[model samples]
Target: MAMIVFYEKPGCMNNTRQKQLLAQSGHDVVALDIRAQGWSPETLRPFFHGVPVAEWFNRAAPRIKSGAVVPEAMAAAEALAEMCLDPLLIRRPLMESGGRRMAGFDEEAVNAWIGLTPVSEPISETCPRSDGMCSVPGRGN
Candidate 1:
């Protein structure tokens, strides 16, 4: 079992589920509450590596779903500035293992990267996890 540092929104249902899945997969999970940790922009930014800044958001959050926060319109500086102010805007369950960090949860990617157990995230048409839309809005912006 690989040791994983998972940062998450404490009361979020989806984050809890993700942690459960990881533990069931036989990985050693160390979960932390992102809000309580008082995140810094530099530290949080790495989790989003290679991912568009827009991908780093929680869909269920009021600020984001209300159409107030749009990632594509902002640069790295703008995005990080906004995220440091509000941890809720940041992605849930940022994961780190083996010196590599990843934002959000992609079952295939997780399995491929760190060898998660065979249990795959359930497929759904209705947004179950409330994670940001696969792509940030306004890609066609």
Candidate 2:
């Protein structure tokens, strides 16, 4: 019922699934390539409203997984600056609708914000692969 602005990394499995769920719920999904977008701290900061700085990151990112970038250790300004430098550091499926913005797809949270169709199986936030890395083309630091 809502027009969702879904920012995602193109070809990411989780993002694809998230979009499908929104569509099935009858929401209009406008999928944009997060990596390709020109983002600034001001524009990108809203998605993580009320969330801790550490949780603003895409945990599946190579830098994070490798421990090269410690989200928990960084300050809010530092985290936002790094994320703006590399969009891959930002969480997936950053969504906006009806002037409200959110990061990540917690089923209950999304459903509460804008109703999601009932699903028997749970929609997970992470990549399903054992390697823990998403198969995103051209993905790098």
Candidate 3:
């Protein structure tokens, strides 16, 4: 079993589900609140290595959803700066294990990196609260 440092937004449903999956798969999950982290460009950049700058953002973040922060329009340095100032802009469940890191949860990628139990239900990376029915009060997806 691997020890994964999982950075997440507290009380997020998708993050909760993702953590449950990792635990059930026999991996040790160390959950941390993403918003509480002291983020800097150097520290945050590694998690998004090789990923397009636009993909570094949390599409469900209020700023992104409101069209205020357009990931596609921002450069790498700019994106990182914005994310540092507002960690909610960073993607959910940034995970690190075995010296490798990943930003978002892709079932196939995760299963290939660290084995996962065969699941019948589909897992979604997007926040469920976006539709206004998730557990976190007053937070939109």
Candidate 4:
């Protein structure tokens, strides 16, 4: 089984579920708090390799929702700088295993990377909360 390094926001329900699915699939999950990590552009950028700059961001973040940060409008360098300053702007469950890294949880993508046990329900990247926001620590529900 692969040892996956999972960066996540504490108290995020979706993150918890993702970790559970990984474990149930027999992978070893090393969960870390994404907000606590001291991320640099070079370090964080690799997780989003081949993906669009806009996809690197967490759409549920208050800054994005409030129109303070527009992912699609920012350049790569600018986007990286912003995300490093506020990890909340980065997407949830940044996963790295076997030298390959990816942002967000796409069940099919993850299964293709590492085997996943079939599940009845669909796993989604978007927050299931009614407000379309995650209850992050120091931020309210």
Residue pairs with backbone atoms closer than 3 Å in model 1 (clashes): none
For model 1, the stretches where C-alpha displacement exceeds 4 angstroms are 120-141
The number of clashing residue pairs in each candidate reads 0, 0, 2, 0
Give me the overall lDDT of model 1.
0.74
Better of 1 and 4 by TM-score: 4
Lowest-scoring 10 consecutive residues by lDDT in candidate 2?
A: 132-141
In order of lDDT, best first, we have: 4, 2, 3, 1
Q: Report the lDDT of model 4 for residue 72.
A: 93
**TM-scores, one per candidate:** 0.82, 0.92, 0.92, 0.92
lDDT of 4 by residue, 20-119 (tens): 9999999999999898999999999999999999999988888998899999999999999999999989988899999999999999999999989998
- Overall lDDT per candidate, in order of appearance: 0.74, 0.89, 0.88, 0.90
Which whole-number lDDT from 0 to 100 does residue 139 have in model 1?
Answer: 46
Off by over 4 Å in 4: 130-133, 136-141
lDDT of 1 by residue, 1-141 (tens): 789999876545566677787888889999987767777887888898888767777666667878888766778888888888987777776899999999888877888987766654552212354553332244420
Question: In terms of TM-score, how similar is model 2 to the real structure?
Answer: 0.92
